[model samples]
Target chain A: MLSETDISAISVTIKLALLSTAILIAIGTPLAWWLSQTKFKFKVVFEAIIALPLILPPTVLGFYLLMTLGSNSPLAGFLEYFGGGSIAFTFSGLVVGSVIYSLPFVVQPLQNSFSAVRIESLEVAATLGASNIDRFFTVAVPLARSGFITAAVLGFAHTVGEFGVVLMIGGNIPGETSVLSIAIYDHVEAMEYSQAHLLAGGLLVASFVMLIFVYLFNRHFSLVRSRDW
Target chain B: MIECQLKINLEGFTLDAKFSVPDQGITVIFGPSGSGKTTLLRAIAGLEKGDSGFLKVGDSIWQTDDNFVPTHKRQIGYVFQDAGLFDHLDVSGNLNYVKKRKTGLKKVFIDSIYTLLDIESLLNRRIGQLSGGEKQRVAIARALLTNPKILLLDEPLSALDLKRKNEILPYLDSLHNQLEIPILYVTHSQDETSRLADHIMLIEDGKIIGNGPINEMLTSFEMPLSHSGDAISIFEARVISRDTDFNLMHLEFNGGQFIVPDNALPIDSLVRIRVAARDVSITKKKQSDTSILNIFPAVVEEIVPEGNAQVIVRLTLNGVVLLACLTRKSSASLKLDKGSSVFVQVKSVAILN
Candidate 1:
C-alpha cells in the first residue's frame, strides 16, 4: 500500500501530465503545420532545434533548464516584477519542465501527420470556399485525427515518466511538485523496497497500457489510409 | 469578360500570359503537357500568386500589382484533373461544405445543377467509392453550388478513359450552353477543344501563341492548330430536319446543308459541325454516283505547303472558309490555286456539340 505522500504524488503527476499535454497541443499544432508546409532553406535548422531534446541527454537538458527557470534567472525576475514568487521549486516550474521534456513526443507525430495531410485536400477546401483557418480545423485536423491521439498519449506518458528534468526543477516537494517517478525514486533511496515496488509496478502497468492504445491506434489508422477496409 | 495578364517565374520556365476571354462561352487553354496550362489557370483563379499580374473577372479585381484576393474570396469554381474531393466527407457532405459558405442559397440553382449533372443518386455515396467520372460530376456540382462567377477547369478529363470522356463531354457542353459563366477550361485534347470551345487560346512553352474565336483560330494558316494533319474547321449550324428513313439529320449553315448520323438533340438546336481537312476532296464539278454526302461550291482562298507531300488548301464557300488538307500530287492533279473555283466533296463530318 502507498502512503499519503505517494498518493498525492500520483495525483500531482496526473495533473501535470494533463496540463502539459493540453498546452503542448495548443502551441504545437500551428508550429507543426508551419514546419510541414515551409520549403525555406533554413527549415532544417529550425527542425533540428525543435528535435534537440530528443537526442540530448536528459540530465544535460535538466541542467540548462534549471539555470533558465531558477530563482536567480530572468524568468523568475519577470515573475517577481508582477509581485509573484520565484518560479523555481514550484508546480508551475515542473509543468514548464514537463512540457519541454515531452515536446518532441507531441510535435514529431503532429508534424508528420500534418505533412501527410495532402496539399490537394487543402486546396480543394479553399476552392470550395474554406479559409486557411477553416481548412486547418475542418479538413487538416479531421484527416490527422489519429496523429492527435498519438501525440496526446505520448505527451502524457512522457510527462508522467519524466525523471531528470522534474528532479532538477521540482525538487520532490510532496503534494506540490513531487510526481510519481520522483516519489518512487525517493522510496528507492530510503530503502523502502515495498513502496518502490508498488509505485514502480503501477507506473509500469500504466505505461504498457498507454503503449498498447497507441500501437493499436496506429495500426488502425494505417489500415484506413491504405483502404484496407 | 475575363481579362488577365500574369507573369510567373517557375523553376525551369516563366509564364507570361495576356488575354481576354469572352464571358459567355467556354474558352479553352490548349497546350501540351508541362506547357504551363495548369499554372496559368491557377493564376487566374488566384490560387497561384504570380510575380506580377492583373486579373479582372467581370467587375471584380482579383489581382493587381500589389493588391491581391485569396482563392476563397474569389467567386471561382475550379475543378482539378483528379477530382479532388475530401475523403472524410460523403458526396452530400462535400456539397454542403461549400453550400454552407455562401450567404445566399437558391433551391433553383441546386435543383438545376443536380439534375444537370445527373448526380441525384450519388449524394449519399462516399467519395472513396466513386468512379472517376462520377467524382468529377460531383466536383462540378459542388463548384456550381457556390454559384461561382467564373469556372476554371484544369484538364478535368485527363484522368478518365475514352469511354468516360465520351460520357462526360455532353454534360460539359450543356454547361457551356446553359450557364453564362465564363469558363477557362484547360486541355491538351483536340476533341474537347473542337467540341466545347467557342474561343481558343493555344499555349506553348509558357507563352500564348495564338488566341481568337474558335472559327477564326482554327482556319488561320498561321495558327498552330492549322498546321496539324488533322486540322479541322468548325461550322456553327442549326438542326433543320431529321430523316427517319436514312437515319440522318440535316444541319443548315451559311454555305449549304450537311447531313450527319441522326442525333438525339432536339430540332432547331444549335450544333457545332467539325469538318476535318482530310475528309474533304476538290473537283472541278459536283460529282455524282459517289458515297460522299456533302458537296458544295467553294473557291480556293490560299494553299500552304505542308510537310513534303501535302498542301493545306483554304477554301471559301460563300463567306465561310473551310480547310482541305490535300497532298501535293492531288493539288497539282486538280490544278488548284488561289482564286480557282471548285466543288469540294465531303467524306466524313463529326457532330461536336
Candidate 2:
C-alpha cells in the first residue's frame, strides 16, 4: 500500500523528469553543436566548466544552486519584480536543479555524436545547395538522431534518480518538491522498512528498465548505422 | 568564361593560381601530386577561402575584392575524389536532396541526367551496396541535376581501382559532349588528361606553368607533360572507313589517315584517338613493304634531348603536331635536327570515345 504522499512523490518525480529533460534538450542541442563545430581558442575552458558538474560531488552543485536561487539572489529578485516571488523549495526550483545536475548526461552524447558526423557529408550538402541552417537540420541532425535519443533518455533517467541536489534546493514539501528518491529516504529515516522497500524496489526496477531501453535502442541504432557505411 | 585569380595560404603550402578558361568543353587542370590542382578547384568552387581573389563564371561574379559567394550559391557542381554521397540516403533520396533544395529545375532534365549517367536502375539501392563505379555515376548524376554553370570534378576516378576507373571514364567522356557547361577536371594522371582534355592547364608547385589547347601543351618541349616517360598526343578524328576483314578502322585527322585497330565504331562518327610518343619512330623515307601502316611525311619542328639516352622530336605533319621519342644515338645517326624533313611512323593509335 502507498501513502498519498508517496503517490504525489511519484507524480512529482515524473513531472520533474519530463520538464527537465525537455529544457535540457532545448538548451543542449545548440550548445553541443557549437562545441562540436567551433575552433575558438578558449573552448576548452568552456568545456571544462560544463564538465565540472560531472565529477564534482552532487552536494557541491546543490550548495551553489541553493545560493543562486535563494530568496535574495538576483534571479529571485528579478522574478520578484515580476511578482513571481521566490522559486526556492518549488517545483520550478527542482527542475532547474535537475537540469544542471543532468546536463553532462545530455550534452556529452550530443556533442560526441555531432562530432562524429562526417565533414564530407556536410560539405557535400552545402555544395548541393543546402544553406548552413538547412545543412544542420537535413544532414547533421538526422545523422545524430541516435545521440538525441540517448541524450533524452539519459537526461530523464538521471533527473528521476537525483537526491542530493533536490534535497538541498527543493526541500521536502510532499506534493511540491518531494520526489521518489527523497520519499524513499523519508520512509527509511522513519524506520518504515516495508514502505522503504516498496519505493526503493520500484526505483530499482524503473532504472533497470530505462537502462535496458537505452542499450537495446542503441544496439538497434548501431545496426542501422553499420548498414549506412 | 570562368576566370579566377585565387591565392590561399595553408600551413607549409600556398596555392596561387591565376587563369581564365573558356566556359565550354573540358578544361583539365593537369599537374603532379602536391601541385595545388585540387586546391585550385576548391577555390574555384568557393569551398576554400582565399586571401584575395576574383572569380567570374559566365555572367555571374562569384567573388571580387569586396564580395564573396558561398559554395551553395555559386552554381557549381563539385565531385570529390571519393564520391561524397550521403550514406544516410538511398540513391533516389540523394538525387532528391538536391532537387528539393535547388528548385525550378525540370523533371525532364533530372530524368535525362539519370539516363545520361545510367543510374535510373540504381535509384533505390543503398549507397553502401553500390560498386565504386556505380557510386561515381550516381554522384555525377546528382551534381548534374543541379544544372550548374560549371562542373568541377576533383579526381573523381582516383579513388577507384583500374577496372572501375576504366569503367567510369567513358561516362565522364560523354558528359562533355552531352552537357553544354564547362567542366574543370583535375587529375595527376597523364593518361586521363590525353584521353579527356580539350584544353589543358599545367600547374607545378602552386603556379600555372602554361595553359593552352591540349595538342599544343602536349607537344610543347618545355611542358612537363611532354618530358614524362609516358607522354602522349591526342587527335580529334573522324571514322572515314573500316577494314572489317582485318578488324581495323581508318580515321582521318589533320595529320593524315590512321588505320586504328577498332571494330565497334561506324563510319562518319567523330572520335578522339591517342598516340603515345614512345610508339612513334622517325625515318628519312617511307617504307612500302613493312607491316607498320601509319606513316606520314612531316617536318621536324623542334628537337630536345630528354635524358642522356632519349631525344624527343616535334614534327609538323600537315598542320598537326606529333611527338616522336628517339634514342640520342639514332638522332645523331639520322642527323635529326630542327627544320629537317622526316617521315613520322606511328606504331599504334588508341581510339578514345
**Which candidate has the top score in DockQ?**
2
Number of residue pairs clashing in candidate 1, backbone atoms closer than 3 angstroms, sequence gap of 3 or more or interchain: 0
Would you give the TM-score of chain B in model 2? 0.97
DockQ of all predictions against the true structure, Cα-based: 0.57, 0.63
Chain A of candidate 1 compared with the true chain A, TM-score: 0.95
The docking category that best describes candidate 2 is medium
Per-residue lDDT of candidate 2, residues A66-130 (tens digit): 89999988988999999887788999999999998999999999999999999889989888999
Off by over 4 Å in 1: none
Structural similarity to truth (TM-score) of each candidate: 0.96, 0.97
Q: Kindly give the stretch of ten consecutive residues in candidate 1 chain B with the minimal lDDT sum.
A: B43-52
Q: What overall lDDT goes with each candidate model?
A: 0.89, 0.90
Clashing pairs in 1: none
